[model samples]
Target: MCDAAETRPGIDPDRLSFTIALQTAADQIVNASNITGSDRGIAKAVLADPLPARRPRISARKVKCPMSRYGTTPHETRPLTSRSLTHLDITVLAAAEQPAVLPPSPANTDRRSRVFRLLAAADPGQDWTARQIADALEIGHLRSLSAQMGQWITQKFLVREGRGRYRLHPQWAKTPGDSLDSTTTIPA
Candidate 1:
């Protein structure tokens, strides 16, 4: 029977054999002239009862290490939080609206500088998503740019406007020829 099933298209021999074995075992147990009447009754009850309906199994391929800077695990939807902007946030937003000159010389060559220059040169009140910045800078990997953006945020070179949106920090919105070092502070 299993050999015939194997020759047929879309039929698995192993599955057919297992089903036959299971049915034979069940028949033997239920029909056996066993010693215990209780065991027979239990087996009859189980056989008579319909099996519960089962959900179909689903399979998905998932990455072990997600490239996103936001979270370690993959998520279908991310929760958006709403909060009132603080004094500093408002100041940064207002300052970000002002146009600033790009840093000179070798500063334009590095990844960080290129990002800063793009954000700095953006039109008033314009913010950039990681993908947008990556596209603008011709960066191949948005994840790499996002990671660098996170670092820039920590270094006070950029301010996060909203989820995945970034703008130049108010502190760094200075005139031309100023040192681009993260440590240097301009007095308000």
Candidate 2:
């Protein structure tokens, strides 16, 4: 029975109806105690019916919409309609064309420097929680700020007043523009 269901050379096994019949037979044999004689007869009858032919695989790719229908060709030019421009429109266009003046970047704009400046500018006695400092500096993640704070504590740049709270070290608690050392300092 297994030899009769064997796929011939160059023939696809999935296209053979005997493959499905063999699988059903194997299943019935494995559950022999559960499957009754009537169940076996029903399986035989179902397998006797002719199987539908499998459709050939489609090789062409499908597109949402054809490009030619909606798009214009390189040679196609849209007709320009001439209209008088109002005084307000001319003023608005001129203003938009002019380059916007942006504020100059701070000299010490690094994360550590910014944190140092913010903490030093505050009251020396005040203790800032991580959340408050993050909110003030617009920092998204507390973990990053916490890690930086840890490093600062080790460097003696910041002092941890309590849990989740930190303040600038007493030695570094000077006004902005006052130099702490030659290496690290708050910019004016």
Candidate 3:
């Protein structure tokens, strides 16, 4: 005869049927032998079907995230509430309170001011690339200074001379006395 425990793939038979069969077999073996105490308890517990391994009867808790339905977007971004903001502020303050090896210094301030002064002094007719400017000013970081030059161009303090070249705005470079039209009336 074919074994009763044999199972076909994709077809799950009744689990209780297998549990009853195991319990009956265990009971028969127990009655025929001198099984007692812990051994008998284990045999009974195994066949008792406490938390069956094959199909766990877990009732899963479902969570719902807030979503928008108006087609503005699938999900709307929720801003941090005041309580969460306070918690974030506290975390940031705690981190900031820790002793840091590198404290804020004004090291780059002088260098940047010097760079602006050099650019301001440059001839309006002339253009200087980042390397030429860096070499003239003895500044080592060409890339960073070039980025600063681009910012100056944006601010209208300098003009881009094309091909990564920069020149101070002609009007910016001119002194009050150097103006072509020196005739001016002062308002009293």
Candidate 4:
């Protein structure tokens, strides 16, 4: 059941809600201490403070343009003036500079290319350890390079002659369709 006398025009709903929240906080502070002499007095003073009145609501139509007070319309435009060449300076320099070299292709800098270059430059009978290859190519991770070298040997890209040494696959060094192992020469 609703009471018709409960609502009051002087008491705003927003102010009532704010008062309720403040009352709850005050209650907590007052009940927290058993010796509530000074603390209770402070909470009481806080709760007794008058609630702020609800701000006046402005409708879109009722809102005044801020620019109207200045007696000037918002964003007034002015005509642009033509530019005049009052001062000018110029300089010329020789164009004998060397042409910029193109950056190396991604393939040329890849791990496969590095490995191929290293092996191709080695003597036919010479074998390279993983550390040697890594050191020559400035690769920091030895173990990882060693693993990749092993994989290359398994893929027949390189030959694993011994424990750590590797050589370019003999077939790659030989001419196409030439399977003779004795005739295969070292790559230039």
Q: Could you say which candidate leads in lDDT?
A: 2
Model 4 lDDT tens row, 18-83: 454456567666777435454443334333453577664332222256554223323434323334
lDDT of 2 by residue, 161-184 (tens): 899889999888886567544367
The candidate 3 region of ten consecutive residues with least summed lDDT is 1-10
Worst 10 residues of 1 by lDDT: 69-78
Model 1 lDDT per residue over 80-156, tens place: 33345465633444445667777675524677776766666666368889999888889998898899889888888
- Between prediction 2 and prediction 4, which has the larger lDDT? 2
Question: For candidate 4, what is the TM-score?
Answer: 0.37
Predictions: Cα RMSD each: 25.6, 18.1, 19.9, 16.6
Q: State the C-alpha lDDT per candidate.
A: 0.60, 0.66, 0.54, 0.60
lDDT of 4: 0.60
Q: Report clash pairs, candidate 1.
A: none
Q: What tens-digit string does per-residue lDDT give for candidate 3 at 1-188?
A: 01221222222233335455566667768686544433443334433453333653233212244452212232435322322223433344444575658866643345545555566565657788889889988888888988888877777767897988887776567564553222322111
Q: Is candidate 1 or candidate 4 better by lDDT?
A: 1
Candidate 3 segments whose C-alpha is farther than 4 A from its true place: 1-109, 176-188
